[model samples]
Target: MYSKVVMDHFKTPRNVGEMKDADGMGEVGNPVCGDMMNIYIKVEDDHIKDISFLTFGCGAAIAVSSMLTDIAKGKTIEEAKKITNKSVAEALEGLPKNKLHCSNLGADALQLAIKDYEDRKAGKVRPPARPEDRHEHTHGESCKCPYCNGDVNAGLEFCSHCGKEMNDSH
Candidate 1:
């Protein structure tokens, strides 16, 4: 079952496409569920001037992607970073319990986009992909996220859990 807000967003998803000149881009997927999301952002003077997304998922995923963009537009990067899966679901009047991962992926995608933008601005190289979940690998690295004091790997661009940049090298 879906809430009215969820249904509305599902049927009329907003900002539902790729951006050609995005300042930042993020992509995330759930292999088990076969859901994927890509978020694009355009920043101007430290503010999110625009945002968009492309999602290969269910109605909940599409709806969350749309809502995530709406929540980030016109906000500063820091403010946008504060957006979370919980807030996204709340914005939609709450997603089905099982569909909450849709909101998680949406928020993660946006955070990753911002990390990409910051990395580019600071002239940092992207990390090589690893097979394991970054969230899991972080625990073995024995370091904490500077922003949230949560576990993170040395090479990660951002904390998998809190979305905090893992280091200041960038």
Candidate 2:
């Protein structure tokens, strides 16, 4: 029941591996659901020369990771950081409602990778202690409302702080 794009990515996922000398790296996870993804990037002169991903997850996770790498490559670090879950899902045509979280996994992975690269350039942070990576954070943390930075509980009807109606499908 997978979409055509998802099927294609699953069949021949692109940029699926590690970059031993990656300029940056990022990982994200939904430990409760056991989906984890690590993304790596290679940079040259502030431009993304390559992007790759390794995922311990399902079909959707693989597809999202592949799509994310493809989209992030050739983009500058700043440009890559702007990539979002909505854009990843759009690039894949569409994912099943339940699989939307996979897109978040991809976005987070990219953001982490970009952050790593930036940190390296600025000498602000170091790489992982181990190459065995996973998603950086767990679930139940991203459902917050952006407008007011308020805690939006799962399945809430409105933003408790801003009185804004929450989209049913978000």
Candidate 3:
């Protein structure tokens, strides 16, 4: 079950591809984790001139990426940085309570891209390495689903409680 806005974005997401000429880029999580997002930004004079994203995730992640770019485009860096998980969830008219953390990444991804741009400008740091991708994790009986935080079989591919796919990231 999803809101119309959520479904609309999931069915036809905006800003869904990579921007090779981007001024900055940010990535969240590893592919082995099974829900990763990358954000690219082209900024001009402290304003966000353009934005795009590549999200290898579920419907909620796609919608969050689309809505995030829509909100950040044309805003000043300071303004865009203020965009948060709570605000993006609200922009979607709200996500299922269990899916709220899915919204936490939009602004974080953007802010990291901005920080990367700044770091590059100062030559103080190279873009950070992506987190190490690890898998074959064996969860204990107490482990919970990363998506819904619901109880799940440690070996299951899908959460019995939420129907969300289970991954090493969980």
Q: Which candidate is the best by lDDT?
A: 1
What TM-score would candidate 2 get against the native? 0.73
Q: Which numbered prediction scores highest in TM-score against the true structure?
A: 3
lDDT of 1: 0.86
Worst 10 residues of 3 by lDDT: 130-139
Rank by lDDT, descending? 1, 2, 3
Candidate 2 local Cα displacement, residue 121, angstroms? 1.2
Candidate 2 error regions (>4 Å): 127-170
TM-score of 3: 0.76
Clashing pairs in 2: 27-136, 28-135, 28-136, 29-135
Give the poorly placed runs of model 1, Cα more than 4 Å off: 128-170
TM-scores of all candidate predictions against the true structure: 0.74, 0.73, 0.76
User: How far out, in Å, is residue 167 in model 2?
Assistant: 22
lDDT for each of the candidates? 0.86, 0.85, 0.82
Q: Which pairs in model 1 have colliding backbones?
A: none
lDDT of 1 at 88: 95
lDDT score at residue 102, model 3, on the 0-100 scale: 73
Cα RMSDs, all models: 11.2, 8.0, 6.8
Q: Write the per-residue lDDT of candidate 2 for residues 51-137, one digit (tens) a residue.
A: 899998999999999998998889887788799999999999999999999999999988988888788888896744563443343
